[model samples]
Target: MLQRKTTKLINKHLLMSLVVVAFASTSLELAYAQKNQTATKKKSSDISLTSDDKIFLELREASKNNEASKAKDLGQKLSNYDIADYVAYFQIKPRLFDKGGAPRAETMADDAVDQFLKKYDGTALADRLRNDWLLVLGKRKDWPTFDREYAQFVLDDDTQVKCYALQSRLTKGESVNVLAAEVKNILLDSRYFGDACPDLVNSIYKANGFSKHEVATFSRMAVENNFETLANRFDVPDPMADIVRSARKSPEVAFRDFDKKAWRTSKENTAAAWGSVGQYLAKKLDPNGLKAFKMQHELGHHHLLTPETQEWKVRAALREGDWRIVKETIDHMTPSVRKRDPAWTYWHARAQKELGDESLAKESLQALSDQYHFYGQLAREDLGMKIHVPKRVAADESLVKQASSNKAFARAVRFYDMGLRFEGNREWNWELRNLSDKQLIAVAEHAKRIGLYDRAVNTADRTKLEHDFSLRYPTPFKESLAPIAGSIGLDTNWAYGLIRQESRFIMNARSHVGASGLMQVMPATAKYVAKKIGMNSFKPSQLDDMKVNLTLGSNYLNMVLQDLDGSWALASAAYNAGPGRPKMWREKLPRVVEGAIFAETIPFNETRGYVKNVLANASYYTAMSSNKTPSLKQNLGTVSPKASVLSELP
Candidate 1:
């Protein structure tokens, strides 16, 4: 956006440079933490920040660490900045955050919050601050004030806040039964057991809104999420609580106890406790869990299994090659849950075929073949058809100019330049809420033109009726990356596919777990790759270099691919979840399993999604890179139990 004769591109980085540096400096974890666009007249992605920009970043850091004194000092220094509200909000937020990291409403002692709310009214920052205040009020049971302000809370998207809203309703004498139903639906997220949610659940149980079975099932779910404290507080009555205790101590012991007469007193409660054990063991890829689940079915207790329990049973069945159980589990799922994943349909068909219902199996797969995704690709291959990419579709060029004039797009570009990805993404998404398919294409095209490679792909991907594969699977640094990939005897397009998924083509992207650069390579992995490739001058800092990241990433990827016998599904899983897991997961396979089945059953939720997406992206990249149609089944190939090779790799 700076005045210049030449235009430039603006792409967003994963995290701020300070966070990336801090993460890279201490990259020691073995597990992966699971978990942009373009524009303009235009702006450089690496645009230099003024002194005010430096102050903004420092204020953000101070806010994060709750350094109120430092943030206040810095906030005062940026009074004249165009977005001084940003600095002031940072100054005020630190005071609100408690030592446990939750904000308390009691911290708002003066008119600081009131003045800021009035000045920045209608802005996203104001809405965000209001949300924070609501959390604090809800925690304190300030229902009158909480109810009044909650109505004005713009993005009522926080689960805890929503739970608090329900709690407020109960305090205001709302019907406990209705509030309980809402609580059950909204409080499923177990990432954290924050204050309001536990209170709400306890109040619901105290009011007898939940039946005995519901209490046992809900308590079982709490234990599954490793919230033993909450489970105990639920006081799941005698025998079942004893079963839960046994199951939590050790899944192996729980499997043995399933045969005990006492554990079988109530079919529903026993199924709940037993299902909890099966779910936990399934995550660990233990086949014995499926054995315990089969006992549930024999005792006619399977009907009591919760949705989460039933879902994990499917994963356990596939790993153990129990085709009958796979078919039975899917058959028991509600129509809504069964249809939620195409994998269920695909596997249900496969299981039916194995169980002597070939015609019905073929009919089911034929239904799944037309869609475009990992399972759809496998279904097509099964039906004797090659997976074909849709013909490229484009929007008109004039829309680019229209997009360039849009205020949200301009600020998004600026925000990306300053490495404020959170703000940039918010601005970009706000404008995309109602864009038509072709308009989305237009925005994507403009984003691609200005070097917003990440946003171009993401925006183009949103279109249901039109698409530009070149924009969606762009090779931003292909000139350097392609040769590195090829030199290592790896597929360049697959590298592009992986990079596209890893960082959305950001050059200096760094994940929270210290996976850095274009490919999001972890520092330890980068160091190991460096040693393997004999790159004597390598330092972890060099991972941010375009060439270095691609080199190490491709090399590491090649090693996994080679060891896994070129199974893209396995390699992709290895890349995301470390080599040891897929190797162990693969070794547990009873026989040669379909690639789609292998991916669908990956125990780690993030790794499962990661493998499916990377292979799907590669399939499209293959079509774009060469005129020939691509086959994802070929990439996912067959996942078989193989012998040693990469067993020694980290």
Candidate 2:
């Protein structure tokens, strides 16, 4: 009798669960109708919490703190949960990743890993499992299983795994040239690739893949790419590697080292030695660098000039505004180096214009005007054209409705509301991955309607068939922004532009470094700005509020602008980095140069990109808001030494 009563209760609850999902489905339709619906409503709450949710939360915390035994106990209680796969994963994670006091991961059965991958298939959890499983396989030198599993791996960004895959291929007697090309790219890039890349190359060397000449070529590539530290590691035939090393440490010492070598018959060694010295001199922008090049030319060793030395020569000339020399150097540049960026294209045109070659300059400018970048905008200005934001592309309502109904995106919206932005983005991107161009626009519109401005912009950026300027350059939070910017004497469009880049209009967005809200004001910065502006009763929590964030952010921007002598370029750099850095960087330049050149030469990768994007974004916003094209050059002006400006603020 008790068993029958329990059965009836289970059936009643099952019916309730179905009704909840049905209600959620109906609410999603309402969400479609009201674009401004709170992202968290119905979807998460509709799924009634059970003991499993509590246990799962506890298990997650335990795993995070590495309380393996505690996690195991909590995880056991979640064995029958709807996301039991995740619980199982947490149960196994510590064993796989932990080094000290952990049991052998190789003991894990192949069926165990295969089961997780097979069940989860397309989920982020599966991708994570693959990574962990691959690591264990690599640790055990189990190449066969790795090879089999690697084919199904998505997100091929793990450099170590890539290196291991290459090792497996080599062990199978396969040529690594195809992957070697990829490796070379990783090596030459400015980003760190960790130990795996060097390890792979070392393995290749042991396998007799790299000849002395090949190693020398790689070393040169490293030096040219400004990866001097990496270049030092290459096992090139002695004195040449030594010269590359000395080039970074002391160009004078490198020149002395080159001078010590007697170059009568060894032309290759001579070229290597002289090229290293020349590169060092050019890198320092030493006045003697050009003289060193002339000396090499006089001695018929100009052919020894590599792309590195040639490019630095262009930078040095650009600093001095030596247009004739700039054009000559550019003309002499290798096609690969000359065509590396549109900056060179713009410079090529400028050089032609400076040298009284208007026709040639016009041709170069015309080619560059079609692009949509810093140089592209400048090129358009050079061609006497206005920079206009492209028209909005209207997505089909049916397509948008379909996108709104995407199960993954719906779940993502719920996750975002739960403050699980990482997971939410993963789900959101998974849905975006296979979408058609039109579908992409539709989803972007859907994301926009739901207040996911960042997702909207990113999605619109991916569409190849459609160009949507309004979607890409959205002006959100005007109600809070306009008054704050106006009262602070800041350009409303510029303030909006900076905020767009800073937080992507996410109201509660917090950066990894603890910047919060739409403006991404750091806690200390918030306090400082509030104090300076005489804002009493300021609380750090208030930084997350829209109005307070804009108020503090605009005041700080105005401060930097005033401090930096009203140069927007310097001010933008100061805003992203700090006030001190832009000041120091300005001191590095002895004379005035165009703000574009100043921006490009910034040493910090993040700050350099930040300044350009903010300025370009500001230009677009200005044009969009005012319905008149603003000159990007006028915004950039020139960045000069603080001393050059008489009676400037300290």
Candidate 3:
């Protein structure tokens, strides 16, 4: 019985030993697999191609054949590779297109359309192609083809309205009155083009007979366009002339009472407010006084409105016995304000101490124990005495030097102001090139002094070639942009043009509406795209990094291009407006035409001119940027009116 029991115990021990060995072996195998996986991941992440890679091999084959078609095919296949591949593809596409001619290129495009339509039917590309087809049909003046295609594709009301107008133009001789009514209907539709009502009204007058009301409307447009001579033709005093005079007398009150409605209803009031301020300042100060005050005020706004600024302001005010401004400044303090305004608290404590409020002053001083304010530490040390020394933040000397020499930076500021002016008035194609280099440089320096760094950088870059100094192109990232154009299938000249128009290639470029980075991406859009591309960890600050910004911007642009059916015109429009608006316009093509006619009839001057300017710019850019310089006929497409059309008409 004892021998049997001992045998049983030995068997149990053997089983336990086998279990431990098995666990150890399994863990070792798992570790080996994990290491192998890590190696594979690293290889995949490299993105750099070797000589033996399929794309490189295909490129080699295409090179030997001297067959442009084969080369083009290989190039397209390699487009999924890194930026190097994209550059190679871009270089090859033009060569292939040049060699094969339009027919061959068109065939390839058609094949691509077919393949993409079949594979990604519901995607942005499919919609884009459909829109392109519609545009082509419209350009060809093939209304039947356009109508047939328009039926297949979904279009937004705005596009529909435009389509209808085009159709009406085509069928004008058949029933002039009917077509005119159609145009008028489109003009009245708010969804199609609510902003262009005035233009539509003028069109209506021309189509029928010009009346006194129509002449008045045309004169108002002239006035809005800054054509004082033409505007003077409507000699009737502005209905709100008295209101404008009243507002001029009380400029501050006018500014305070300014709202969207008031500005829209009374141009005289707006002119009065803006002109009055200039006149008042002119009277109050010397010739240079207004300019100097503007510079000083802008600088003060930048440096004195921040929490740190507020702290400094309060301290300075307390010392100068100017409590009113200090109190007004600190009234709407945020948490960031409290944290950054240690100097403010310190000065507040001093004020209390001066008032013989020892207890409150002591409490304020004690509060600084855990904080790291500029004046907090000093306040703690000088709690019992009057705090007099002001801590000054040093300006970056290199940055200041660069800013001072940057002419492009100055131009950007001027252009920005010009844009604002253009927004208020309906001026068209006001080019920045008209300004002198000296003026641009001065503006750049002024922007820098006022903390408009992005504008300063833009202006500086634009004036770089003209200036002999290296200070204009001080940013290292500017040098890195050479490879960016080719990588994105853009010509260097065109890229420069676009950048000049966009952000002047300033990596830290930001729009007033919170668009950030070189391409001015909105935060939400950036985040969405980053995640879509598996860059889940992208931070908002990365948008300011040149390489990252270019990569993401190119990707976003590709997406937009795809969405807009490869029409750079529509893509540019979508970039300005949201993609949804453009998409809706495309979907409701007929309705959109009506809406556009309606928009033309709109009394709102701003939107009327905005659409026209954007369209005109897009047309110009498209013609200028195409591989071949498009003919005037090609540029304007079917919309090009006959030489005598306008003259022969009304």
Candidate 4:
């Protein structure tokens, strides 16, 4: 029942299940057998519980429903439960919201939390409970208990918590200037880090830790990034904040309005404000705005341009293929700004090459080629070197045995076997914190032996001295993939490359947006492809079937590939970020641009990265499959607005 275009692909052959490369001789079946055996040997004998266990479930349900009388009744019947910590947590959690005044509620919550922490001090749930307790203490303004509990709180990256901690320090007459850098970082972050962060920013400004000029700089930055709520709270005057807000909808009017008020502020501050609006226009894909702004206005010397302004200047020039201007903008940036990010460093070298300064460009590329990243691969390509992948080293029995015996690793394995991957990955990564490079390699090898391909790839990436290409860039479903790709006239390496980036060989990996299976196809996309290919009675659930999913995914990819005129770079971007977005991005180009520059200028951060990684992965896969060096430049061929004859290929 396949459509004419797809019938030949399906009729070509049977499914192949054997993998091509063998980093470890352990097959998927053998790994599953090992997991089953381990589970059988280690499973606790007393899994089923007595009638008393029903009380625990009742208490949990009562707590969830916020039923105070039901919880109170269940609490009296739970004294004999073996899980004393959980029982205590379930009893106290609902009561933390008690309306009987703040101090009394906090004291009750604190006592219950302290008891749980005392009993289960090292467990993950204890830390989770402590966060709830800290929130109560923060609300009650009990700085003493809040400080003590906050100090003991691990994983302290919560922005709101840090803001409260700062409030406590400031209340005690501590100089906020001592934490100036940290304050700026947390305050300026784009995400709404909750009310506490804005409250902390207001506190710091009132405390004179942030000067008027500093406050204005942050406001301008907020407006440039279209964070209006943040811009409004920076104490900028209502009229000026209004002008900044207008930049999003009317950049030209915003720029003119900003100019009229230029003489009211200091020259440097005025430049900063002007730069913010200009950057906004550039980011909005206004082709002439940035170039005209630079030509007509005085931004002082190159070194005096704000980091934000310089970044937009470089981006605008790169978008228009003006290499000289790109080099000039980068040269004006501070050494720290230019040197910190590999993206800027790579672009500086690229500009140098286009400007016929190969000596300097070569030096920059040479230094960057040694690292592993999107830019590093580009640097390697610029230097005419193949992507260097280290030889696969087999794991020794002794190393494997040692890794299996490690307590934390064993806990992770047990968690994975119990279908608790979230907990398993957490335990696994947490244990990796203090491991030596050699120990990490051994642990990665053990993960590979157990068919934890995702863990194996991630863990192997951590090693400094040793490198293993086969483990890092594995082709897990080669037998099923190769013939299907060939039958469809698609590059097997390219298909594998896209799949590896999409799911990392995790068959059941579901994205946050519900993209499922090996190729991460959405249910709607699957249905459409299924119907288009004359597949009858197609159930959405068939997306989980490996062959069906690959058939639909590869066909969709090939369709996109042809529609975009055989440009893998565009097709890769199209696959991740839809076909419409890349077309719009291409239209923004003043003229046909190099694929690298086009990729670097993609407005969506995720899609930009997706295109680069997929192409780079395809290049490496090509090298591995053909046993010859693949040209990264050829892989990322120049993208143009016009379609090619390949678009007509059927």
Candidate 5:
């Protein structure tokens, strides 16, 4: 099973059956929209609709077509059209902006939106409207209004709004130095920058919020990360811009031409350039990545690189088995970058230990060992301790009752019923933001009761003081899966671990790449495995079948495991990154390295994380299932060349 990000929803008829809670008689408008959902569904032609249903459906179409007059006329025909807020929203949206994103002077959207916000304050749609209105205000440079609304922007998740928030600060005559650090963090990822973000960066640079060298590094970092729009808007020299372009289009050529063209600019900053090219090369798996990084190391500018490039340098050095370089590169990283993820903290400690700094290593490992994740378990092993589960905290009946009646949880269920998972998860997480450990466990229990296993596992996982491994690592299809795994000489715990990560036991889950079911197997991979197991008349569509999907998924996993000399870490990586990739990585190994080190140096971020999580998840499952000490170090074993490569495993 590879990556599957898309959620597969069942029939919409199921949605019609879901009981949406009515907002306590306070929302007479939305109540009308939901109250009739309990009625039996009939064919459109066979149905004799009520006057309200007819008016509401027409209002919906009118609003969709932006027939403002027709929608208003329809709205006037009914006092209770359930979801009246939506009708109001549709009417105001067209008025706020016509076909383009401009409000005509004749439109009265401003007053209408104010009324909607007042009526629906604290609701999800109200927050959404505020977000939309803030964008319009941002475009109009209405700083006072933007500032007021931005304060109530519950999510504040939009990059453009974030950019506008900064711009509003500047408009209020805030000191550039005061906002410089925030600006830098915002501009870190240019791809999320959107239209307003580039201008924000430009404004900061032009206002001297950032120095020339700092601007250069940020701009080049953006370009190297496949975002050229920021660099184009940046006021850099033509030569520097050209260098970013070359590096983007062709890293090898740019790396070669960089030295010759260094004097073209002020020659004050080559760190961004070298770092940019090296990152591009490193991503391509080219040997010149190390060569270019060595140049940055020689110039003493490694620390001047972007955080991503700094991480790549560390990964590149680790892959090369150069402990000194790994230590040095990690040392050059900023403190924030070094401490952001436990993986880095763990790797830094390992690097130091490799260089005979046990005192430094022990401190980092000791801090990291308290966690129970992949890196945490590895850290525990490094400190010579076995993996152990934290004591379980039992949920109470009172907490369960509170969770069952939770208004936010009810709304989340409604959204999930409508297959709007983004909105549902946002609502679910918002409620979780302030909940106590006890409340979280109760919420998870309630979620599990309603067949929301993904939410159940995720919520249970957030508990810090008390642990519940059964809730965290739920076994949805254990009855069917255990024997299937055993028949193929597979550890049922490993299957559960991989399945937990893949689809969270959602029977109908589908990924962005078309992988499906609990196994998250690709359609093509499903067919290949089907044929290998002599499955006649197997269609890709049948991947949704529980029994068939498990059979194929387990077989594929065992195939990779055998090919990888039974190394769980290697097989897990192969499963995620393809069996051939792990082989290639192993073949490049100067000598056999520790499994954890090999995993740490994995080039693909997603696959690297996948391997760690899958194996760690497997270890946890083992600890819960058997009377055994689940050791991540033992699970990982030693990473080495495959005993016998399966060229056709893919």
Candidate 6:
């Protein structure tokens, strides 16, 4: 019995030992597997591969194949992934809920709302989404959320006028008050939005209940729009008076009507009757004569009209030294009329001097300084003699005094006034190169107040020492830029450097191609950026505001930086051209170094030159200012893949 019991115990112990060993081996295998899995996950995360990552990959593939349906599906998936992923959300939402097909009203509404909430920071993108939402929702008043959003929407000038007009009709309210205010605003702010006045004026007229002033305003606008029938309704003095006045001031008129015989024959007829003169001139003048006449018109002199013969008659007075005729002409001339003629520069100076008004004479001479080349260089030389260029004032003592003194605002204004005067005289360019840092700051501050942000930025940039270009780089904003810069992982120096180069820091700077604000951002670009930032109701005007411009600009810079594989140099280059071009450039030059070779080889002269200037400016700024400059070469790595795609052709 004892032997049998011992045998059973031995068997049990062996079985138990085997079980323990098996368990240990299994545990070790599980641990190893988990470790490998974690490592794999870390690798994938490092490469930005999440479950939703395939959506982007698929979308790209779909785009490559031009597979709209697949792209739309993937886009929807990406958009629905997370609200915080603005880029993906904006990218996918539009495709998912396209406007062309039977509109997925609910989907579009949600997408727009998502876009708005994400980019609520007042970006151009946000405004676009909001506009989109309003457009899609139409007159549907049931959606309280849409109504609420609309109520808070920051309507642009055109939209505001339209909204007011619509509200007046919907609510049975008088639009005259709103129309009047808008008309006045339009007139005052005409330069802000050029050539869009007719549409706005028409919208105002269409609104309910028009007043006499509104009628008159509409009549004038009608004439401007070439709707002569509507324009002739209001029996105001010949509706063509303003046009005649405009034509009279135009230089082309003078050249066309140069024939004294034609003028003597047509003197009795109305000004509009002189349209024949333009036709005659067009027939008679050669291309060069026509070109010269057009150039003169652009120069803002109008010597064409029969009614203005008296003004020209005064020119003869000056030529013949007939002071009595000059005095008589001056007496009869309106200030507006007096201001138009370049001969006034000479006449005004002579008259002021003869009248023994030394101060007035000096003022006239200063005004005529710019006209020196057109009239004669004598006036400018005389003015230069009297007004010695102001010495460069030290910023340390003078700045503090100017900043604190009651005259601080006044002094800054005076500096700007002088700057303008210099600009008018074409002297600012030379004077700017010699300005003290203190003077530049003062001028910049003054420009900010007067809405000349671009000039201020330029002045600051020009005054900055080439070496210390980055130091204390002036921004239009007083605060909040650092946080924005941080959010986008951008070097403030680089940002400031770009701002300086792009617009010379001008808030209202616009390019001939329709870019606006300090960054010279295109409207379409601003719209995209605004939507990306989720600013639901951004107006284009807000771009002029420093904070908005910087925030959007920084975000855009960040996007470009990422797209260019973290190369600041390439990013800067891409910023000038689009990312696709840079990507192509990098692909084509895969063996080259980023900064030295690829950047140097960029095809677009404008972009290549721009990149070099920006980089140099940034380096200088970083050195002078406290900011650290990142290495252009270090940040952007060596070229990698020889992309089969086309080289980024700038």
Clashes within 3 Å, all models in order: 2, 0, 53, 0, 3, 24
Candidate 3 minimal-lDDT segment of 10 residues: 16-25
Q: Candidate 5 — what's its lDDT?
A: 0.71
| Model 2 TM-score (2 dp) | 0.74
lDDT of 5 by residue, 1-650 (tens): 12322222223332111100111110011111231212111235434566776676677667656667877787777756655676677667655555544334442578888889999898777887888788778877788888889999897867788988999898778999878777655554556666677667678878988776776676676666656665666665223556667876888999889977665545346656677677777766566777778877777755458778888887777766777878888887766677666778888888899899999999999998888788888888888988887777877879989888998889777655544455466577768867888888888888888898877888888888876777888888788888889988998988888887666666766544566677768776777778988897899878878999999899888987887788898888766666666776777665677888788777776667667778888888888888988878878888765443445555
Query: Tens digit of lDDT per residue, candidate 2, span 125-180?
Result: 78877876776676666898888878878866565677778878877878766656
Candidate with best TM-score: 5
TM-score of each model, in listed order: 0.82, 0.74, 0.27, 0.75, 0.83, 0.33
Q: How many backbone clashes can be found in candidate 3?
A: 53
> 130-239 in candidate 6: lDDT tens per residue?
55455344333324555555665553323333343343343444455565454543432222222223334444555533433444433443433344554554433233
* Deviating ranges (above 4 Å) for candidate 5: 1-108, 237-241, 259-268, 302-304, 334-336, 641-646
- Backbone clashes (count) for model 1: 2
lDDT of each: 0.72, 0.67, 0.39, 0.66, 0.71, 0.44
Estimate, for each residue in 1-650, the C-alpha lDDT of model 1 and write its tens digit.
Answer: 10001111111321111111111100111111111111121123456989888888888889878888899899899889877777788888888876567766674533787788889787777888887777877877888878887898876878788988988888778899998767655655455446667667777888888766766665666666667666666635324666656666777777776666635377676666667778767766677788777766665555456567788888888877889999998988655467666778988988998899989988998898866666777778778887767677776778778997898899888888887776676678657768987788899888988888767877776776666667767878878987898788899878877777676776766544456677777676677778989998899889878899889889988988887788888888777766666777888777888787789888866567667778877887887788778888777778888764534444
Point out where model 6 deviates above 4 Å.
1-425, 430-472, 539-541, 624-630, 641-650
Clashes of 4: 0
Error of 6 at 64 (Å): 50
Better of 3 and 4 by lDDT: 4
lDDT of 3 by residue, 595-637 (tens): 2222221222222222323333333333334444322112112
Error of 3 at 558 (Å): 1.4
lDDT at position 598, candidate 3: 22
* lDDT string, candidate 4, 5-80, tens digits: 0011112132111011101111121212221111111122323445666676688667656565778788779787
Clashing pairs in 1: 9-450, 36-455
Residue-level error in angstroms, candidate 3, position 381: 75
Estimate the Cα RMSD of every predicted model relative to the unseen true structure: 8.1, 13.3, 32.4, 9.1, 8.7, 27.1
The TM-score obtained by model 4 is 0.75
